[model samples]
Structure formats: C-alpha cells, structure tokens
Target: MRIGELARRSGVSERSLRYYETQGLLQSERTSGGHRHYAESAVDRVIRIQTLYAAGLNSKKIAKLLPCMRDADGRPNEIATPTLVNELTTERDRIDRMITDLLRSRDVLDEVIDTAADGATTDPASLARRR
Candidate 1:
C-alpha cells in the first residue's frame, strides 16, 4: 500500500509514518519514480510502533525493538540485546511505581467521596471540634 493508505488503516498520521521511517522504526521501498511503497504488514507495524510510543518508549528504543518484530516473511531476528534488557526492566519498574501511585490517589479520592456521602465535613476545624 501507499503511505496514505497505511496511515488511514493504522490510524496514524502520514507525517508520523514518515517520521517512523526516518527514525528507522519502519521500512519502506522506493518505487521507480521514488514514491514510497509499503508492504501490507506495514499497517500492523505502524500499530506496534504507536503502541510502543504510547508505552512511553522513545523513538530510539522503538527502533531497537522494531527489528525483533517479524515481517510477513516470518524470519526470526533479535532486536534488543542484554543491555536493552536492563532498560526494559527499568521501564517496567517505573510503570509499576506509577500504577501504585495512581492506586493510592484513587484510594484517597474514594475516601473523600465516602466521607461526603456520609455527610461528614472532613475539614480540619470540624475534625478538631469533634475530638
């Protein structure tokens, strides 16, 4: 397919696809007139690229990881080495911490909601008077 078709199918912008190609996260072939041509699997590749970006991975990291993804040909290749494994691990830990923090915030909000529902004024002055 062409770039526009790929962009439409993948729900990614044409500029983003071009940027991905420039960043080496995606590959394309040039036609006789120099127009870019992408394989059908390019749609899926774009989706994966968007997913990694949404996961907070940078373009460079996604470039390193993209090679591990197989093309339609099904050839096996390893993209990330041992060094990247450490980075991935660190990312995972950071994600875990963010999740924990979000849960804590949610708990606090829930408590506030419960207090309000029970008609409790949790103001410092009210609490002092109650004590």
Candidate 2:
C-alpha cells in the first residue's frame, strides 16, 4: 500500500508516518517517481511502533526493541541480548514506579473529590455510590 493508505489504516498522520520512517521505526520502498510504498505488514508495524512509543519508549529504545518482538512464526526474535534484556528490565521497573505514583496521585484526587462532593451533593445515594 501507499503511505496515505497506511496512515489511514493505522490512524496515524502522514507527518508521523514520515517521521517514523526517518527515525527508522518504519520502512518503505520508493517508486520510480519517489513516492513511498509499504508492504501490507507495515500497518501492523506502525501500530507496534505507536504502542512502544505510548509505553514511554523513545525512538532509539523502540528501534532496538522492535526486532526483539515475536516473529510472524510466533517465536521470539534473536535480536535481544543479555545487555538489552537488562536495559528493558530497568525500563519496566521505571514504568512500574510511574504507575504506582499515578495511582497514589489518583487516590489523593479521589479524596479531594469526595470531600468537595460531600458539601455540594445532596443525594446521599449517589455519594455513597461514589465512595
């Protein structure tokens, strides 16, 4: 498919698709007129790239990690080494800490919300449900 098709199918903007190409997180071939073309698998690849980025992995880290993902044959890729494993482990731990912090923050926000609701809300049933 073409770049536009890929972008539409993947729900990504054309600019981001180009950026992903520049960052080496995506691949495309060039036509004789210099238009970009991608294989059908590029759709899945772009989604995978977006997922890794959403997980807080930088382009560099994602580039390394992408190849370590499972192959089409359902087997783990051989691209991961012990060093990469250690690095990914550290990243996972950092994400875990961030999750914990966010949960704590949400708890605090919930308490403030409950306190504010206690005064403004007259529906005891609704407030009880909230708590």
Candidate 3:
C-alpha cells in the first residue's frame, strides 16, 4: 500500500511513518517513480512501534527491540540484551508504583465522598490536619 493508506490503516500519521522509516523502525520500498510503497505488514509494525513508544521506549531502544521480534516464519531473531530488558522491567515497576499511588488517591477521594454524603461538611483545615 501507499504511505497514506498505511497511515490510515495503522492510525498513525504520515509524518510519523516517515520518521519511523528514518529511525529504522519501519521499512518501505520506492517505486520506479520514487513513490513509497509499504507491505501489508507495515500496519502491524506501526502498531508495535507505537506500543513501544507508549511503553517509554525511545526509537533507538525500539530499534534494538525490533530485531528481537520475529515474523510468522518462526525464524530466530536477535534477542533483547539483558540491559534493555532490565531497563524495561524497571520502567514497568515504576508504572506499577504510579498506579498503586493513584489507586490510593482514589480511595481517599471515595472516603471524602462518603463523608460529604453523610452531611459532613469536611473542614479543609481538618483534612489538612488528617494529612
């Protein structure tokens, strides 16, 4: 497909697709007339790239991880280095901590709601004192 079709199918912008190509996260071929063509798998590739970006991995890190990903052919590909795995694990842990903290905050807000529903006018100073 053409770049525009790829972008539409992948839900990624055209500029991002071109940037991914430049970053070696994606590949494309040029036609005789110099128009860029992408394989059907490019849509999946773009989704994977976006996932990695959302996971806090930079393009350079993703480039390394890409070699570890394999096609349906079951061919062995390069594995992620221990260092990269460690970094990813640490980031996951941090995200987990943030989630836990947010949940605790939500619980506290729930308590405030209960108190308010009970006709308790929560004194700001009392809340600060509790904190």
Candidate 4:
C-alpha cells in the first residue's frame, strides 16, 4: 500500500509516518517517480510502533526492539538476549516508579479537591492541613 493508505489504516499521520521512516522505525521502498511504497505488512508495523511509543519506549528503543518481537506465527525470534532483557527490565522499573509518583501526586490532589468540596477552609493554611 501507499503512505496515505497506511496512515489512514494505522490512524497515524503522514508526517509521523515520515518521521518514523527517518527514525528507522519504519521502512518503505521508492517508486520510479520517487514516491514511497510500503509493504502490506507496514500497517501492522506502524501499529506496533504506536503501541511501543504508548508504552514509553522512544523511537530509538523501538527501532531496536521491533525486530525481536514475536511474529504472526507466535514464535520467538532469534534476536533476544540477556542484555536486552536487562534494559527492558530497567525501563519497566522506571515506569513503575513513575506510576508510584503519579499515584502519590493524585492522592494529594484528591485531598485538596475533597477539602475544597467540603468548604472546610478558604485559607491556604487550612488546605495544607490534612485530615
């Protein structure tokens, strides 16, 4: 398919697809007139790229990570290693910490919201006091 079809199917923008190509996260062949052409599998590839990005992996990491992923046959590929596992573990740990911090922040915000809702105190000092 062409870039426009891939963009429409994947729900990603053409500019983003071009950027993904530049980042080596996606691939396309050139037509005789220099237009880009992608394989039918490009749709799935683009969706996987979006999934990894949503998981907090950057383009560079996804570039490396994409090759080792399981194919449609559901078998492991030949590219996984202990080093990569360690790096992925570290990324997971970072995400865990981020989640922890966000939950804590949300708890504080909840307290503030509740206090305000109760009309307990208009003063900043009263808001600072936790029940």
Can you give the TM-score per candidate against the true fold? 0.78, 0.87, 0.75, 0.80
Q: What tens digits encode model 2's per-residue C-alpha lDDT throughout 4-112? A: 9999999999999999989988889999999999999888889988988887889999888988898656787767989889989999999999999999999999999
Can you rank all candidates by lDDT, best first?
2, 4, 3, 1
Assess the local accuracy of residue 59 in candidate 3 as a C-alpha lDDT between 0 and 100.
93
lDDT of 4 by residue, 1-131 (tens): 88999999999999999999999988999999998999988898899999989879998888878878986567655677788778888889999999999999999999999987777567676678854
TM-score-best of 1 and 4:
4
Clashing pairs in 2: none
Which candidate has the top score in lDDT?
A: 2
Error of 1 at 22 (Å): 0.9
Best by TM-score: 2
lDDT (CA) per prediction: 0.86, 0.90, 0.86, 0.88
Worst-scoring 10-residue span by lDDT in model 4:
71-80
Query: 2 or 3, which is superior by TM-score?
Result: 2
lDDT for model 4, on a 0 to 1 scale?
Answer: 0.88
What stretches of model 1 exceed 4 Å from their correct place?
A: 70-75, 117-131
* Alpha-carbon shift of residue 39 in model 4 (angstroms): 2.3
TM-score of model 1 relative to the true fold? 0.78
Candidate 2, residue 11: how far the Cα is off, in Å: 1.1
Candidate 3 TM-score, C-alpha based = 0.75
